[model samples]
Target: MRLCVPRAGDPATATAPVAVEVAAHLLGLVGDPATATVAWDIDWQGPLSVPLTDEHAVQAACGIMHVHGRAAGRPAPLAVDYASTVAGVLAAQGVCAALLARAGGADVTRVRTSVGQAALLALAQYLAAATADGDDPEGCPPSRADAGQELVPAACSFVSADGVCFELEALDAERWLDFWRLLGVDRADTGRGWRSFQQRFATATCALPPVLSATVRRASFTAVRSAADRAGATVLPVRQDPLPPTVTPPWTLTPFPEPGGTTIDRDGTAAAPLEGLRVVESARRVQGPLAGHVLRLLGADVVRIEPPGGDPMRGVPPMAGTTSARFSALNAGKAVTEIDFTTDAGRRAVRDLVSEADVFLHNWAPGKAVRLGLDADDLRAARPGLVYAWASGWGDALGPEPPVGTDYLVQAHSGLAAAVRPADEPPAPSLMTLTDVLGGLVCAQGVLAALLTRLHTGRGARVDSSLFSAAVLVPRGPGRPAATGRPLHTRDGYIALGPRARQRPERLAPALGLAASASADAIASRARTRPTAHWLPRLAAAGVAVTPVCTSLADLARDPRFAPALTVGEYAAPLAPWEFS
Candidate 1:
């Protein structure tokens, strides 16, 4: 979003006309939230990447740049206006919750959201790990080898001998070793590489042996595919052709009729939109659990069902008071109960919990639920009016036999990896778990919409959302020609120039003591002659919007702009990405 500059003289506002116009655009209404009715059963298509005034500011302050830049091995922001997209989805969530509240007999009126808070929510896990005590204090990227200036550490997305840049995924360690060994990698290197390769999903840093890339570079994509297939791994080429932009909602809410279903009745206004609602989440990883987390943020009493001894992610790394900070970031406020869902007893236990819950959500593999006799149908039968949400990875788009169906691989398949980088750059997926976070929000959106629909029809819904589906919501348009608003290198530090400053570089040229050639390079060159502090005031005085690039996660805590959205504790966490009035 740093690159998206609103035209000069165009105003930026988040509420009233802008908000009302967006609301109107969504519901075909000329009114505000107060009069919004569940009768419309409003289904959101999507908004174009908004030219938010705080886009880059939020990115810089919230450590999003640090995450993305580190992954790219450069100081970079997402090519897509990701924060604004998240903000838009979050806005839809708030509205849906409000609709649910009104339908529940509460006089709900207004809800609030911001790009800043959405930014925090996007990187909430990463920030938590940074703040949490961990063995790997210095997270990879900005690769420390080159003072963090080198290309991605020779792992992750790789180019085939035929020039096809592709992502390879292997969840099983033996499969990863099998694939690599097929390419004639030494037993020593493959063994070492697997250690970091397995940790990539958790740590977001895959510092593997360069021989892996060298091996892939020498092999044709056909060879690579053959090796993967033989070894039980998945390989997907990063698509250059963009997926057709999504014009429909990211989730599906299919309602089931209930002859004697009951509508919820509330006496007075509650603390939040999802107050009194009970959500039973039996989900693993980011997409499903993060959805539950967002529901928890909206005031749902979320009860997380885990296997006996709890989800193993609790011991992954980066501990915050003995729990995985990343895990706790998504699940901190939820109540948990252990159920060995692999067993008949455990499946029955889960069903019992679902019987008393308003919603039962999960992201189990394709037939795992059915194998256990606990698919959405089973749960909803146990609780007739239950909102059964399946936070899927493939969303039935890939037929019965789907590919890896995880975040990074989905980015490669969905064209997002190609979309997030410039045409000239390699198609590298950001290690920041973008798809998972967005998918989570998409699932939460479906759940809320289903709940709202239930208030009117008194029928529960089957809400399904997927990482692949969520990927399309972020449009792959021709973005800004140059990222002029990204952080520029100053003598002592980096600072970001905002829309006003970037759109009119000539206006900023004089501020930096440069002549008519106020190109991005010129500004950056001159910036390096002085410290970031030296130019910040000068740029501001010259009416060029400027803010420091918060390159460190710890720095964000001290940033006043970031303080409002965060809760400082054993690990840093973001507050609910909304405001209500």
Candidate 2:
């Protein structure tokens, strides 16, 4: 099996240069770089690097805030190239997994993923439900707040008197009273309900850091963190320094020499490398389900087992009638089975499923696997050659793990929140669940490598990835150049201009009826004089990267390049990024 990709300099292609570089890195992992090929598509450009055809348009119109409830019209701070890089990484992982299967004697040929899919995948957790409609009425809370923003009463950063910042999350409704008691707030002054209490707290903390700072100043950071942990709350010191780039590779492959368990033969199987493979996915939330989703796209048979009430996400917001658009999007290509894990029968059924599966994946809280008898050793005992993958908040190497490892918490601990914050503002996490998405991709990569090893040694291996580790792997540096082409207002709508225009200022000047030496402000002023219709064709003819800002998925659906990617029926959906040739 040979992996062929377009070369970086292919004259006819506009694939992202970064995407090509990432693809090369993945191919290097397989130890056979000579077999890969690269081609160029003339229509491709940097903007095309984003998987979705018109994502920039969407962000521009929506204002892309990380925390909900901000005024919609506020323009987002200058954007960075997050979605494309993540898309590149995930695409590489999918291809590598398929190639591994082929190396293990499966007759697989190709694998693919798009930048749009990567962007959606990263936001899976947040997008699974609508803001006001689902099981969680409050919607996804802000992971952290900017200095002057309204802090989420339950989960936010509070500074100590010593000027040290600590993140605290105590979101359980039933525990509000308990939390008040723990904080030594008098019960007599406690408000009537959760809402009232929230209001009171909000009023008291109107001064931002000073209010929370004064409250926690009575105790040391260590004491506060310890108490928060003891009360089933999550607390961590806010890491201020940017984390150095990952010193260790994102995925690790280990080979076992011992012979054991059942072996799968790929002979006469369908062309997809994983066509005959069976996967038992006992995971919930973004990380595990996403890993399963990727494998399913590559033609593996994935059975997602949920507890009796179904995965909690089934009831998340932004529903399309009775179905959760978020849940359906991530889980569209797989089979689902509900088993009551609390019963002995359910446990046995899961064990039986594992015995026949090529992979077993889960992201249960730490120690829960051991309690449920679903640890790597127990599952491997049932199917000696089974690939077991564990996704968590933090890996075992981070001794004495915290009680919680959600994506937001991991962001705070891993320095991601601080890195993205403007120098003058309080820390704000990425608007998307960046860590969860990356962790899922890394999990798939590890499982694929283990599968390859299993084919050779007939012994399975354990693969681990954590949100913390994934966050660490994301590259951070000086921000990319701002979209020099600003969005220009016209009679009808706004049009994106700049990037391509910057490259050919001579051509852009004539299209916008401006002098070649015109400043950006001058060009913008000129563009506003005409309606979008008058300028779109003229600018486009000159090869300026321009398009109307898309306000919704429907807007993107109208584009020929994006129409095929839309999954329309009872509910509208975006198809997974990858495609097999």
- How many clashes in each candidate? 1, 21
For residue 42, model 1's alpha carbon misses the true position, in angstroms, by 18
Q: Go through the candidates in order and give each one's C-alpha lDDT.
A: 0.73, 0.58
Tens-digit lDDT string for candidate 1 (204-279): 6776767788899999999999999999999988876555333345777788766324565454568777787899
The lDDT, on a scale of 0 to 1, for candidate 1 is: 0.73
Best candidate (score: TM-score): 1
The TM-score that candidate 2 achieves is 0.75
Top candidate (lDDT): 1
